[model samples]
Target: MIGSKRWCGVAVFLVLLMAGTHVGIGAESLFRHFVKAKGDCLVDGDQPLRFVSFNIPNLLLIEDDMEFVRTNPWRLPVEYEIEDALRAVVQAGGTVARTYTISVAREDDDPGTPKHVLAPGRFNEEAFRAMDLVLAVANRVGVRLLVPLVDNWKWMGGRPQYAAFRGKSPDDFWTDPQLREDFKKTIAFVLNRVNTVTGVRYRDDKAILAWELGNELQQCPREWAEEMASYIKQLDPNHLVAGGVQTHELHDWELESRVIDLVSTHHYEGDPMRMAANIRAAAERARGKKPYYIGEFGFVSAGGIRYVLDRVVRTPNIAGALIWSLRFHNRDGGFYWHSEPAGNRLYRAYHWPGFESGDAYAERAVLGFLRSAAFAIRGLAPPPVEKPDPPHLLPIPDVGHISWRGSVGAYAYVVERAESPQGPWQVVGRWVDDAAVSYASLFSDESAQIGRKYFYRVRALNEAGISAPSNIEGPVTVAELSFVDEFADLQRVFQMGGQVSLGALGARAFKEDLHRLEMSEGAWVRYWVPGEIREVEIRAFGQTDSLSLELAVSADGQEYGPVPVVQRGFRMNGRDYPYRVPVLVSGRIDRPGCHFLQLKAAGALQLGRVEIRYE
Candidate 1:
């Protein structure tokens, strides 16, 4: 008899299979379709299977111990980090995820440590177990995983390590008989491995949507990719296979390959129009031959994200699009990989719940576009022709207040209020005519009681109907005698090093009243508290490790001491907010002194606002 764990796995698989059938397009079953490439589109049993996915390359690489392989035989602790990342994808209305490099190497390098490969023909059981857990979690969460077999660059010991094993150059690994056999062995090992947690073999797992031959294997000949894809198909006939090629490597043979199931392209152009145009062109090229996907796209603004998403959703042949990545604070405390600094400054992984980041634009807008597009691609009824932008809600001392940037082509706006974030919300206000103009819209709840929290959201309306609701921002308690310095008027008191600038930007903060303070190693910022302060609350956008802030206070404006505060982060509705860091220095501030506050940061930091509660 199969073990209980195995039975549970099967049970879960069946439930997911049933769920897939229920949600399948055009009243068809996804199980019956199995994501086949039909006439340049991925179809599910006569229904199109269009998807929006995110790249979480380090899903299998647990943050614990960093051991290349699990040396301990016991089940590796299931890291919630991976689940959290997957949750972000799902919450954003994504149904698929494409992970980054899964490396296999003998000796671990500092930057690229934790190689999954112990040696040629020898495999790391621990690393394999981690992947097993990933699939198990993916199954439970109902998100499909598209796993790439190997990397092309040395970052993951792809081609170079294969050659290094047999004393050959990276180029020779493609043609060398021994290297080719070694690669095949690796493929077999992965394809046949049984999951220790779920008790299901990798080949039989339905959670896996596709098997990628390799990531960006441009240096390798088309024949190599075709051969690897064929090899994978032979081992696991159930899942689809992709070459993972970009536009540059789009050869006719590769597109026409019988084994390859999908054609993928990567784009990172700065211009939104150009990126959309490129995707359109690629989709046109792949039409009627194979399904097309923008496998990777990033380093663009929120508008760029919208532009590209619009193009992909409108294209009939394109299967879907996956952003470059999504990062979780619990994983390595922050972004665990190298991202373009410029992109980092503009856009990072779409954080869970809050969706706000240090990026130049609000991710709420991007998420709205993505969620709508995802629905549209899956053959769901299209969302309103235009959705209202997320409203910005702030607590004005002794008053109820909310504001929002206006939506284009919207004739009216509706503001909704609720007692709780997840709530039975009621419409509070509706504005039209001059009131609905962009950046000129504002609402004040005159009856909102002081000291009581409230939540607010906004939606735009046109001739068609009401758009999707904006980002919910509240539970903001109206306070008495609270001095709020939105950082809009504050001058840079001190900038030790790194880039620091203040601006009224980001949808999460008060209108045009946020600051972007970039810090390097050993960098710090000092600000003067406006009045006698009892407590201080700092609002900012940050990932756990990538950007963190330390607050210090001084009575004489000279000697500073660390302030005690508990930093609490939260996720709601597919966005993350590290908002609960409050410094209660009542005694110090009540002493008729303590005027200056200093912030010291170890890693990159973005300072948003500083609020002081006083007598």
Candidate 2:
């Protein structure tokens, strides 16, 4: 009888353990609160919730042939990738992530690739399972998600695919009754389906902070957005609903709608004051009826980011801001989106852990600002806001002197000097004044040797701490100009034609530490040559047999003629990773006094530093 009792006890214990595992008991223990919208702010239980989030469009979709996905099919190992991305967000002091499109199209038709939506009304169990892992991992990692249900663009098999599936135009999908019904069915199918990995229905899942109707639905009528938002709310009242509209599309009635929980807007403006003014106007229009979120905002300048973020945190009605994106180092051994569109070309990808090589924006300063703003929005102590704008270094001709713009609100400024653009910089001067709002900061390194290159950067300092180092300016050499474009700052100098972009250097070069100009076939870079020229040396990196390029010298920017080129290949440590084979192309400009020098890629190649040996 005692032996029988022991067997029964063991069975009971096993049953309980199985039940706990199914419900994600371990993950549930970590996050005990569910996020809810209360007035204009999101709250977790009794505590008001404020978050700085990032967008990761392809979090759930995995490349089927990846080694991790192939080996761990049962466990849905792609969650590990999601975990890496989420951990980066949390580490950068971000609390939420706004994913791109969660809805995959029925017509994707790629057999080898994983499809989220296999067919109309029929979902891919494997893709759904991947989503299940995303939520499960999100809960475990303590990051909230704002999931977009569909896409405004065709890249993800969005509305266009939906319309195509039904033999209708993309616009008809919004107004046609049958298409609307079909969309509702898809929504019902997703929300009601039981998560295979989590053992919980998505409607019941608390990990999702909100449901975005669709991404940037500017073409869709406002009424359709309202209808879709309402339909989602009817299906699942647990989560908030956001109309993912651009700033221009937002209306007062939309914010006041009973179904719409938040109003989201995107901004890609360069002007900080204009960006802030738009936000303030949106907040006023919201009128505390619904929270306003800057769903997407990115700039090619650190000052621009700081300006937007500073405004966002100070505004009481604004819920939070999520930057345009964050990219992870996936199992594929590189970051995603190699073929990004031209408009999004300038936005840099922030890597996990170190978050280095971010374009234009300073990673450390941006993260620091975000962390502080997150606290401030939550009614916690304010973060230090003393980081100053980067000083612009302008070299004076014929003198070994440089002048810089003074920083606002800086108690002092520290100037540092380095031999190369990538620095082991030593402090050259310090300008200090307790009463001064700004300093007339200038330095003359008369003791420096002539003909040697010198790099200079500056930082603002106060009692709280020092700001991020300013832009690295110089290689101020006394040598006669051959050609010099470090490709360090391309915002104002370089002009691109055809299909070329500024990208992080895959291979390291001399003066410019991080960036390179990537050129596809027929693409070119036009540089205005200030003087009469002779020979030009181009440093480029690409596949040995694959890369072909030509140098053209033109008196007018419009027309050009190719110069004779000599190509050589060598090995070097790549900036994107390490150990890359690159090619160096050299040529003579037989014609002098050319106004423009155009570097045209005969094939796909990356142009690093361009130096012209001129007369």
Candidate 3:
């Protein structure tokens, strides 16, 4: 296989390796390296590796004072809330989990220093003590903790005061024997920190994915990162050493220069596709020594997040990506980050699970599909471009969004929704576009009664037509309903059959009057006709104004009698069948008091229900 021999050489080498014949140094070394860096050949491990870089925002949500979470209703220690988010990732198609934090409340401009802070409780102990709880949760969930090499400190003394103490750059500190000794000791401590929750040791736990040296090394000097990388390799050689590279700092190669285990970076720019290309280019300079990971990529909302994921996952040589963070339910605010619907939304479109509150199930529709595919692709030949789950109806209350899955080529999709599992169903959304499955729409319910259940289903829509419904998905209850009725019925008037209805003598009528629908169902509606009339009447709100047929009749619904004023109209409002226009009559008629007048309807229709009252 060396020196571009031919396909035959690769076949021969594969056969020899299978036979345990011990091939030549050149072939053997290349084979082993490929096998190890890629994955075991026996299994289909060619799928790209998936690593999610999450800035857990752990400490931020902790007590605002950097105390226990209980004191801060808005904050929960990472241990209490991170599992669901990570589990969401696992369900979404992520393979590796990495987390970060601010440690303590400090100035945004403060010089980051690798020092301990004076805080009470276990974290106050330093290293293992400071992040014991975080490390514990990481172990419990079987993931890794990305400990920032700096602490949150005050910036009041200005950048110089703090930088001087913390080492103006990586060079200022690592080049000095005293500081280098301290840096090495810190690395040793970090590598040794164990997770007590799962009984899985730090270096031992397969869960501890990788160690990120610094969140974004460009915050310091590139030379400092070079020193830090060397220190890390010398300290711990087993796990992957990563620098949380930011997109803005892609040019910082100090960490990349050393024999680092993985090339990692973060992107905050809205474009993941462009960012992926940028990150891949930077990672390629590593000479294929290690794979690349997007540790801190995130979107401000669901759409952006999903789009970025699709772009990054499809890119060549990309290991995987992690959203910037997860946090308690809230409106959009805070640092340059993005979260799941279980987290926040920047604008209102359709309803999503994480919109107002968090819904773990909605998240699973996407996450679960991803995890399954990731598992399938590990070490196998890189799969044709894959997709997240298609938008299928779930027996859930609403559609958080819809997506498709497949290699980049022709694809079909279907959408379905229902009040229950075994009953009437409706198709709300569908597409045959070749775009990979991803977030599509927001599903919400306003009329759903609390505690009531609903169902949904999806099937592949192909060249012929719609396919059979996938499966009965259901049991989504209307958790809450905030009906404001701000617009009233002023918008489009909906009728059962898209037509007007008339039934029962004297009791009902159509084409009655002109009046706008208002917030109060009982508000009055008025109209006008040109001409005179001894009597006048109109129908509305499922009922007629009255049966007074005295001296009123007209060929034109707009005109009534000799008196031009008779051609005028009036109106009323009340609960009645919708889409049934009120009927009006005016002008002299031979009959009087309660006489019946018949008016023909143009369409046959049935109103869900009807209401009528005096006009």
Candidate 4:
């Protein structure tokens, strides 16, 4: 129930981080044995670590900030987020979890940018401290971590970032002598870096399963991998080093390399037959040479995944497998969401226990298969899943604006209301997926009597059943003034014109979330509120930095002109980005009856949410 407690004030960030620090320290006494790579297996003692887990790519720093008009979605997660991620790993019955690439600074980055490696031979203290908590929490939970050193992609600032810093081509990351030595300095910094939370050096931490060179470094030459693997061994003899290339076939030199203890590949081949062939081929290559595993897979059909996992569970040389990715519970509310334009563009990040939005990717069935196969790989039957913990209902001033911190692994939520603090409760709303509203209030009580005082509570639910009721939030009274549309549904009271359409669920482009409306060139959405219009505020995201939106209001839907509105921006990820532009429709001599506020983008913009204050 302590999880339901809330923290407030300007010191909240520091408070949550310090809280995370202590919680991580508590795990120091838990699983501390580093996994070693024996021939064709990774073992803690004599038993190899086999798992059908997931790739929690954002376990350290989250990039999916999709909150309403949030300018930047990049920031370190709080303790609760870490706990939920690792707990999901445990609930899935897995021992080892792999993280995404470690971020590095680039030429374009300023001093304010948050990255693990600031520059060659220079490391960020705060970034590493954030990582220390990640490792600490991993140690506290019964999970081992596989940390990737850097990336080949620009998304996280890796190969090209280093090249830009050194004034060379991106390919120089593999062959150029100066850049190789520079990268070694970065590696040494990480290996020698001590965890501030647990007082354990990176090289000595048992929570780490292996140190991978980089993520999907397919461009890495064979000789460079050998040299770096050996270099890692010299710096950190306590852990194993794995090749981070993205391939279906493991080359002979990789199997024969003396320093490379483990060989792996990422399989996203959607064809079942081809995936099976790749699995068998990779297993044969590492049969008696090195420990082999599926570093990442899935986003394929459920039946296709069944075929692939079946082969993996049966293969002796294939030690384990991890699926593509999952997003955990956010401390503020709901789950953090990410769209993988990479994964058939239909599957976004899967919330644990699954929901209606994930039906397209068979999220429930695939997760069920993962659970059963995870245990089956270890020769055990799947166990029962536990009901979720109580949710944390955030306090609200009005019945129209209601939200709560979601319970991890809970598929849905039910909202209950009572006239008094402790009386008979009434079910106000059922089957609420916090992510379904996507940055909107989780539930709105349109049925609340105007002057009636009310109390609200919520409970999380999934296949295991309903969880205990959340903390009560109360004394909510609807006043005589206000009509707020958080934009959970656009078709309810708005009319669309020109090139405007509801950005459907699973659309990953431009940080698009559920219920968001996308307006292309010359498109407009007219908002009709049945009241005397006093003020209107629109929160939106522009596709381009230069494009602007035109806001106009009319007594009817026809006449329009440039309206007086104030534009605003907020600080995010160390830079100023455009934020909620509160368009103050000033005047008490307002339009009687209904007021129509129409918004149109000259080029393009995505509508996040809207608010209409009227008398």
Candidate 5:
């Protein structure tokens, strides 16, 4: 019934299409025209659309990149994250952003990982709804989307998953008759999807610029590309189609194919000379044929990136260039971070407006360049950065742990604390970035006396000015803890043995630390402390099953066994454990540890961080 109303609105828009423009009616009102492909340029009415943007890989779906909070590693992005991402693009002056392809579920995905397509011809409603929000917010924020239909890599469950559905080889996905038809079902579903919020079908959503066939497709044949592109055109004539093949070389068939309207390639050359040459070669080839752009590129110095971007601007027929990728703030606190292992482990996902903490990558300078280049590509001057709005402070569980949903473009924030809800307030922290920490508490107020009550609010800051105070969150009680290990350093580990490692199967490069709790009776890590164990707490990822995890303590480092366990929610000091990735356990255990405790897993699990209150 809800979908019926949405379609009826779409029908009304069609009837009034040639009449005039309308606003505040539905999502279609947000975008009055579709981008058109006209001989090497993409146009919205008369003006061509070019962008110096970045791919928002996790915008529609997420591979939870925070190592400290790593769990199933595959979770759906929340509303806060989706909005912040589109806002980041606007802050960078980018008009278009790309997202990772829809994920297909596979048999061996680590226990809790999520996939969009659970079975052939079936979809995960939760995941698709997350996608609906992406389109809705994109329209509301005035940013355009370039969505890929699927992926070639198994990292996010791609070709292999589809082929597996039919009990065939992964390569069969391209040739298998049943598999080809199965994939078309997905294509038709996406193009016809009605935005639950905007009531606009994806095929008609002006927020979307074009639909790419898949993400950097590998081993794809020209015949397959032509067939799929033709199929997509049949389903949605309102949007242009881009060939997502990962290489610089475009096949003659792709360039001449009537249905394939756009051509793109990914680049990662670190040398300026080679990168420039590569861009020229591709642009020259696509010239006079189809609209061409650099779909993805990065992994160089800031200056190197600028040089490549300059090459893109100067090279004829190259419409735009989207840098490697961008990530946004986490709802619970801080930002979701991902390290690019392919970049020799140097680059991580970028945040907007850049912060000092990101100086290592020259994030500030690079983003500054992107903002100017975004307008420069369109032959316009860059505008001044806007003032930041007040950030929304999350409910504080204790003074030791405070976090907030940061304002867009806010590189820092000023945290103010007060004795009463309405009394004199004092600055507790300044120049604080919600992204300084990943998936952890944003700030810790060490000055607050234990057992004292306080109130707190935070204001966002950028060049313009500090924003007004955010909503007050407090009467927060102060708490303390003696020992906590986030698993970043291994020096604290007294003993270790088993199938566990620092990272997991498909997510090793995410952050450099995170202890994967694999299923093994012998898998364990032992730590030594200097006091008797009184109360215990565990922050973990994955379900609590009979074999999930158990804590064992020993007076001597040689012996270990389970202690009486009492599970609790929230932190012992009244701090709330971040529940975004689902903190798995918190328990009170009795032990005579001359201070040594061991964590063991009898089944697959993920341990975020452990807090032990001891004397």
Candidate 6:
């Protein structure tokens, strides 16, 4: 699996190309079709408006963590990776995915100041390459993109003069004339770059959503905010621009007032309804300036999703919402529940019935609302979003075992499996309620032989009507499977050291023994070996005393137990030892599922060589 960091770099690059082109259609052509077709306002056609967002730990751009990039290196591979990540969203029904990238001005060469963000566009090869890849990916996947270019990277782009007026203070960065020029240039570079994703050079894609100027501008001086907002409007008239305002900060509104095309807020509090109300009031009080949206909002419980949607949908002028993130880390003390795909929950609930997550209530409630909304949005409706044909549908969605997020009433699809598309079809599973239309039909060929082929199709029924069968995909064969496990070798030889730093020694011969011994300090090496796996082997030996060749094992890599010692009749340097025990021990690593397997020396034995082979 590719690491998330490289994926993030790809997102950053895509944001640079956001304003390249504009769609020719006006608000009437787009939104009229949507309202007539029973779709969302932004989705001017039969398709549901696809909006998705991910919280990329862009800060991790500089940090090193094995978990973030296990197989893929941090240096971006290409622009397509960004598209690849977005493709996942597309498949999940998202037409837009937001990334907190140009949240600030970025410096290319590490400008050496503590407060300066890097302006690496001029010097960083990786940064440039990653940016290029992002455009390519967005073009490939059919999703509109949004990037909040102001925050952290802003102060880095030579806008030191503007920085002086930041926060409540007015004399820090605004006084620097050179800093002001730098900031202007930085904005020009970004605004002028053509977004390859939309085909129109930096000023054209109509599908392009909004260019969020600042993530949250409590520190952004009101004057500078107005200045930048005006510049952006004059610079790119086609796209909407807004600052991703933080909670209820009126100081931000001074800047929020003039520069933004829309008022964007990130609301995720105990009560999303209450939060939405406050923001709605703020937008309304702005008079009839622009639209308002809960650009980002989500909570620890998936149930909060319902509350948020309920409030936003009821608000008169609010356009739509973009969940703060589809997936994020638990390390930051935030919830990670929104990561699930739409069809997952329903399938799980079909099997496990009452599996509750914080958002269970909301997820359950949303299905009926979506069906109602889909039916109600007549002005936006054309033909309804197209579902893939028969061969593309899963024959047996494990509905009973699905999670709540995937259990939408509208997704309940009927799956029919057959030896061939033209032959007899059998209903593998069924859910008839209008809400069931939201359930995705998932099927598998447990009986399918390795190289065997099969075909499938699905049908869904919502209040708008039953969709035509999805397109046919294959009479295709299931191919063999394999895992590259590029880091497998590195994980081995990760030894708990006896006297020296095993990491230092392993670093020298990393290619050779990366898995067996990791650098650690102790008398014995305790390496983690997974159980129920039979493709690998481990063996250890002592060169000196044969009697000291005893071995101990532990379920957890930390605590070890004694293994029966057998005396070998082999003596070294005339020592009366007769232990030449066969080192080919063939017992399974006796640990429970998901437990760690550890091997240790029995006595004060001279550690020789340990080998693992996959046959």
Higher-ranked by lDDT: 3 or 5: 5
TM-score of each: 0.60, 0.59, 0.43, 0.84, 0.78, 0.48
Candidate 6 residue-wise lDDT, 1-615, digit = tens:
124323433442343234223222121111112111121133323333323333332221211111210211122323222433444344333445565544232222233222222442333434533554454455444455666655532322323324533332223433345555545655666677664333345445443466766566545665666677777778777666766544552334643364555565666554656665666675565434455455665542444555555555555455555554432211211112211223332211111111122233454343333323322222212123333222223222222111111211133455545668785866654642222211111233333334556555556543444555544435755442111111223344445445422221211111111212222223555444332222223322233424333345555556665545333322211111222221223233333332333444445332222322111
| Top candidate by TM-score | 4
Residue 37 in candidate 2, Cα distance off native in Å: 2.6
Candidate 4 residue pairs in backbone clash: 27-140
The best-first sequence of candidates by lDDT reads: 4, 5, 2, 1, 6, 3
Pitting candidate 5 against candidate 6, the one with the higher lDDT is: 5
Where does model 5 exceed 4 Å of error? Answer: 1-29, 65-70, 479-615
Please list the C-alpha lDDT of all candidates, in the order they appear.
0.60, 0.62, 0.37, 0.74, 0.74, 0.39
Q: Which is better, 2 or 5, measured by lDDT?
A: 5
Structure candidate 5, residue pairs in collision: none
Q: What lDDT, from 0 to 1, does candidate 6 have?
A: 0.39
lDDT of 4 at 242: 89
Kindly give the stretch of ten consecutive residues in candidate 5 with the minimal lDDT sum. Answer: 569-578
lDDT of 1 at 485: 39
Model 5 alpha-carbon miss at residue 86, Å? 0.3
Output the better candidate (1/3) by lDDT.
Answer: 1
lDDT of 3 at 102: 31
Regions of model 6 farther than 4 Å from truth: 1-81, 88-94, 103-129, 136-142, 152-175, 195-200, 249-259, 327-615
Off by over 4 Å in 4: 1-24, 395-398, 418-425, 451-455, 474-477, 480-491, 494-501, 518-535, 539-589, 595-610, 613-615
- lDDT preference between candidates 2 and 3, better one: 2
Whole-model lDDT, candidate 3? 0.37
